[model samples]
Target chain A: MHDRRSFLKLGAGAAVGGIAAALPSAVSATECASNIKWDETRDVIVVGSGFAGLSSALNAKRQGLGSILVLEKMQVIGGNSAINGGWLAIPKNPIQLAQGINDDSPEELVKDQIISGRGMQNTDMLRQIANRALDAYQLCIDTGVKFREGFNQQVGGHNKARAIRTLHGVGGDITTKLYEAGKKEGVEYRLQHYVEDFIMDGQEIVGLKVRQNYRFPDLKTGKTIYIKANKAVILAHGGFSRNLVLRELVDPALDKTLDCTNALGATGEVTLTAMAHGAFPVHMSFIQTGHWGSPDEGGFGWSNALLSIGFHKGISVNVLDGKRFMNERADRKTCSDAIMKNRHPDGSPAYPVVFFNHDDHIGAEEVTRAVRDQIAWKVDSLEQLAKQFNIPLAPLKQTVAEYNKQVPQRIDPLFGRMMDTAVELKPPFIVSRIWPKVHYCMGGLKTDLGARVLHSQTLAPMKNLYAVGEATGGTHGGTRLSSTACLECLTMGIIVAETIKSDMQA
Target chain B: MMKTLLLTLVVATLFTGAANAGDLVKMKGSTQGRSNHEFIYQDGCKGCHQGSGKQNATDAACVECHGEITSIPVDESKLAIPEAHPHKSLHYNQGASCLACHGEHEKKAPVCAECHRTWFKEM
Candidate 1:
């Protein structure tokens, strides 16, 4: 292994050599007005190549920034944006031009966002995001992003079904289009680079130090590169959804179960780096946890699978000494919390088994088949199924019998099972074991309405440091609505670009 | 002096034998126990081996010689698929690597399809 000092020496040497090699023969007259290192000085430096980073780079170029640099830590350009369900929820988007969807106004949008945010939302921040959503959506459309039409519906708190999705299917498609657009606009995309930390001159962020992946066979040794920016550095690196330490630091309760769909690089390292440089992280405790999958299985939890299989409409009985505990039809989070409470006497990890009868199985089968063709469903007598699942047969039988007896009334006195699904007590019973898992982190580096990173307590904007996408938090107040994460990314990307442009011009 | 020389030869032989055995095992494992001729299929093995008529190719030789495997068109029709689902397209084109999702690795093939297929029920 190379010594740290030796590595630094090599990196410094390589950086100097690389600069000497790539530096323009003479400083071009059109270069930004700065005497900083030629390799370091760019009018705008975007610190990710996801939806937000790419958007910022393209918009910055459009805004006449002399030199634009997009640094991607991954080996490729698109970040998590390339791996997500490509849904962009813009309430009252102009793409509604072709479709007769309900038109939304900025005030209504603010109202909806505030309601979804549930008093945790910064109203001013939300208002800013709402006001510019249409223009951003239109901009995306103009840049070859085809918004899917006709499938608009309420996700979480929105009063109307105005969320627009990409025809490219999911996040990756939207990101690819944006990346292509950025490339067309001459955005210098550097991949396989990890941003170590922000270069700080006291409180102000001046530049960033990055390390390129030298592990490739072609490259002899990895090198550290410094990027100094004349105008601004936008952090579109995404949220800390996969960082356990950061998750535990922010919310201790989340330490128990926080399973996210974010990438491995989503370690919240960028957030910590920002905080180390005096950036405040807000809404740390606000986490999104609705879907519950099998703890043993590594994917979206079983509760979501069960919901997909119509289990939400079935009777859910929490068996404690052969007795029902909570109402079965309680909200998903509430149900998950109850299951967590009943894990074991010593508070071991809880695994709640969902029981359903033949009718419930049919409903579940319909839902599951619609989502995915591969789902293992078993049909057996209630007692036999209970025996197969290792649950006590007598108690489970009694629980199902009672649940079925109550089902005729069409109202569950125990768990408030609504939606009028049949009682799961008869032959051909099915059960799925599930537990709660951590999903997403709603807290990140504190930012202003313009997506500018701010000092924690003072609320002062960090100089030339902007944050968009999941890297910055302040948009989703306490809880993130279902599809708003993708929406937040695209809207904030456009917002940050426009803000940077205006700031530069001023 | 004779004992020391013999011991040195023994140690050196053991080390070299172990390394050669490991290499052979790895090569066999990669081809799923099939011989080089059967595993490589067609003349795919020749570009790396070059002048030699040997079927087996070294990792270094493969990287140095046939590094541009995608450029050697197996089929042009495969590339003409319409861009509908980027996630699916990434899976189809990149295979299984980080680039299938994150997008920048040039050499590593993206493996979104293999992993996501195993875990993601929606996929």
Candidate 2:
């Protein structure tokens, strides 16, 4: 890795030359700051257009920070945030209070986050997320994000029913509004501007070497130019869950053939660039594979909607044993790990199926589409379901009978899953195979409470360099809970803007 | 030597400008309505991409020929399932970029499949 000291020496050499050197024949991200002529200058350059980046730019511009610019590497804005299920987990919020879930607090929320993250959380950052959770939800509202009323559910790993879905149940509803709000606040967004590296002045980040109008997955498409950041550069470019090389680098156990739910642009280049500049990477090996992903269809497909419904209304059973495995409503890591353990002797995932009754009102439209796509099987009876998946019919019937007995008492004798309003599953079942997709990277560049990127060598804050959202680590340590990434991103966006404003005044 | 150098530069520039177009031409019968070559031949690289600047295909370019997506009526009879109306969506009806899902050079599945199994064929 290129150190700050070597870049400082290059800066010194460029200063001696006096004239800006022409860009070298070979495209390189690491260039001496002194030898570069900035194509444009912004007071603050937010390197992403997701919830974190746009929120930072919008909040910073609202705070009267001048000349803020948001850069998106893809042709589109929002990155993976555009396609996410817009479920923001906030504790003791008005939504929860209205629903009679009055037993949640910021302390409780942080405790749950730490529990899900396997106790390796940066407690301070988790507290920041917990404290600002309501504020983050309000930010979404103020920015014109319409939350669906009466759609709040207790997602896996959260202690309470604090997760609220957006109006359309997709995150684009949030991002499109955030983008529009940021634009209205005079925050300029330059899409297709791929930030390659930080242009450093000694140890401090001064500017970025960006490729403008860059085509995705194409290395030498856009014209490389350096843009000076007069105040700060906020790195909110998200994690590398889709990048197979980086995924294999940290966790080789993750199958190379596994599908991902991330936007095609969710790669490791930007995070890797920050690491090259001495930003410390944390929790790199703690990648989280989503338990809801369906093996039958590509990406985060229709089966996801059904599997979530199946958690509460149905049962998830291993096809081999024809019996329920782990709790369907367990934490994401626990569920994914449980599914992974039920592998064939050849080391392939058993690809267990989650099934709910066909008449269940939970996510009907989603199930219809999944069945149409042939990813979900809608069989008439338990015998047909067992026969279709080639499972033992007797064992399947016995498992369902056992689950039915527990449903009446609202108790699970086997795995201790919540059985609220769950009835005995009947005929005409909707069954879909469950396979783990490289969903979210639980690890990224480590940041302090102030959202400043920390340097690996000195363990000090990298001056004028900040990070937020999934791009920064330690908020959710080993594993992330459902709906919290949105909360963390929105919260960090607010916190980073305040921190940047304070730094500017100082 | 100078003539040869100048020729190489011109060829390299042209090659870089339509590098992705080469990938499009190879996928002859893969597209739904028209063959990949027909779109390239009739419209040219600049038709979809809009310029030689190596930028992505603009939504405006797509809409110019395809018309406004949201306004197009889906015949419910032809669809295999209900709610298969690909054009009219809950979010960003006309505002979403066409290139977000429909890739000419690189074949991309309908991004709706990313979340829902809305098995709408690629336009």
What is the lDDT for A22 in model 2? 18
> Highest lDDT: which candidate?
2
lDDT of 1 by residue, A1-506 (tens): 23345445443443321211111212121222233342456778888777777777887787777688887655545766666666666777655544676566667767877777789888897777677777677667777776666666555577766666666456665676677677788877776566655666656677766655432212223455667877888888877666665566666766545456555445555676677667888887676765455544333423465644435444444434445666555666786577666555676654556655545446553445322423334547765655555557688778777777777787667666573765446666555555666666777888888888999767898878999877877677877766666666767777777788788777
- Weakest 10 consecutive residues, lDDT, candidate 2 chain B? B31-40
Question: What is the lDDT, from 0 to 100, of the residue B77 in candidate 1?
Answer: 40
Alpha carbon lDDT of residue B4, candidate 2? 52
Mark the 10 consecutive residues where model 1 chain B has the least summed lDDT. B100-109
lDDT of 2 by residue, A293-324 (tens): 88777656666777767788888898899899
TM-score of chain A of each: 0.82, 0.81
In model 1 chain A, which range of ten residues has the least summed lDDT? Answer: A19-28
lDDT of 2 by residue, B1-123 (tens): 533543455466466685322244443344322232343435545755656525555566656555677665567786654544556554334335566567755557665665554556654
Off by over 4 Å in 1: A1-3, A6-41, A75-77, A94-103, A214-223, A296-309, A317-325, A342-350, A355-376, A417-431, B1-123
